[model samples]
Target: MTDDRVLPRAVLWDMDGTLLDTEPLWGRAMEEFARGIGAEMTPELRNATMGNSSVDALTKVYEAARVPESGRDFEADEDAMVARVLELFATDLRWRPGALSALDLVAGAEIPMVLVTNTVREVTDVMLETLGRDRFVATVCGDEVAAGKPEPHIYRRAAELVGFCASECLAFEDSPVGAAATHAAGVPAIVIPSAIPVPPKPTYTYRETLEGLTLDDLAAVFAAR
Candidate 1:
């Protein structure tokens, strides 16, 4: 079932937990924010919005704790939290296991790669600079788009920027929101579940992580389809 010649024209990567191991830093920042407002930050609440946008994540936290803060106040708190997280991330960020190898593999195959992330440009830039992958062919930040994950706009935009059709691209993701976005864009997705477990369904493909994947591995995966 291997189709060695059917490699994707482009590979779309998710930045946060997929490429960088920064989810714990994010959780710590969110917990600190909850404590600042005298809210009970429980593991349940954190799990609920593990892969959501900052605004949506905070709104869910507030709703679950029954905190009474106006939208503006919440936004301010979220901004502060994100700033703090970015600071910590900038100092301690490291790419996930085999991430660099995966990137090199794609690059060697001459496959253009795009970063499609829910993180803002500032944070993403820091990550890109740190990892020396700032020269990605395209990037679509969640804040720049009208709708973030669970919507196909970001993926569609990334495809457009890279001059590839959605169907000809392969999306790499670690969250359900990212998977849904890729699916909505009519692209096949290779999921690498992080903190959240991927749903058991027939809609998408799964990989433990990018640890041992090579360019040939990806080409084989796509060719089999």
Candidate 2:
């Protein structure tokens, strides 16, 4: 099928599951956190809170494990987990399937790519540095914005930093919250499911991943009505 949406001047890419295979690492960290707090971490609970901000995710972990939030010293745990995650990335970090190819395609097209993610600035920097994509035109981290995913502020800020109107940018996301935020910002969003399941239609366009896509591939997808 020919996709005829207007071609975007820039593309906003999600980090974490979209570009790197970090969601499982995050899950492991969360599991460790829950165990450290003597809380029960259930798959259902994880599913419910997948794609949430770190703060929200931690809060859910605490609530689900029946742990007391007060005096729980989440910061220390989070710090330790981040350290471990960094270590894991140092060895295990790799681009998701077809990520490099897709990025190359975009780069070859001379389209400015911005990393827009709900990750904290520090972690986001680490991922970008590790992936060697630190040269992105701009990066908008959830912590840098007043509100995170599911709120359009981050997406709007990213577009602004790239000097593009929301309508002129295309957002690539792997989470419902990210897609919602992009949509709310008036940008066209493409969903690539990772750890989180994609919602049914009437919301966003779903792609397997960026695999098998070239600049021409994207152009064709975006040029369709």
Candidate 1's residue-wise lDDT over 1-225, tens digit each? 954377888999898888889888888888887777667778778777676777777787777667766543765776787789888886788787788888888888888899999887767777787656654888889888988887899899999998889989988888888888888897788889888887743446788978888766676656667
Alpha carbon lDDT at 206, candidate 2: 77
Tell me the tens digit of each residue's lDDT in model 2 across 1-225. 974445679988888888887888877777887888777768887676666777777788778767776756678766786787777777777788988877777787778999988888878887877656655888888888888888899989989998989878887888777777877888777789897686743436678877886555455545642
Mark the 10 consecutive residues where model 1 has the least summed lDDT. Answer: 69-78
> Model 2: runs farther than 4 Å from truth?
1-5, 201-203, 220-225
Clashing pairs in 1: none
Error of 2 at 116 (Å): 0.9
lDDT of each: 0.81, 0.78
Listed per candidate, the RMSD to the true structure in angstroms reads: 2.4, 3.0
> Candidate 2: which pairs clash?
3-223, 3-224, 4-223, 4-224, 4-225
TM-score of 1: 0.91
Q: What is the lDDT of residue 62 in candidate 2?
A: 78
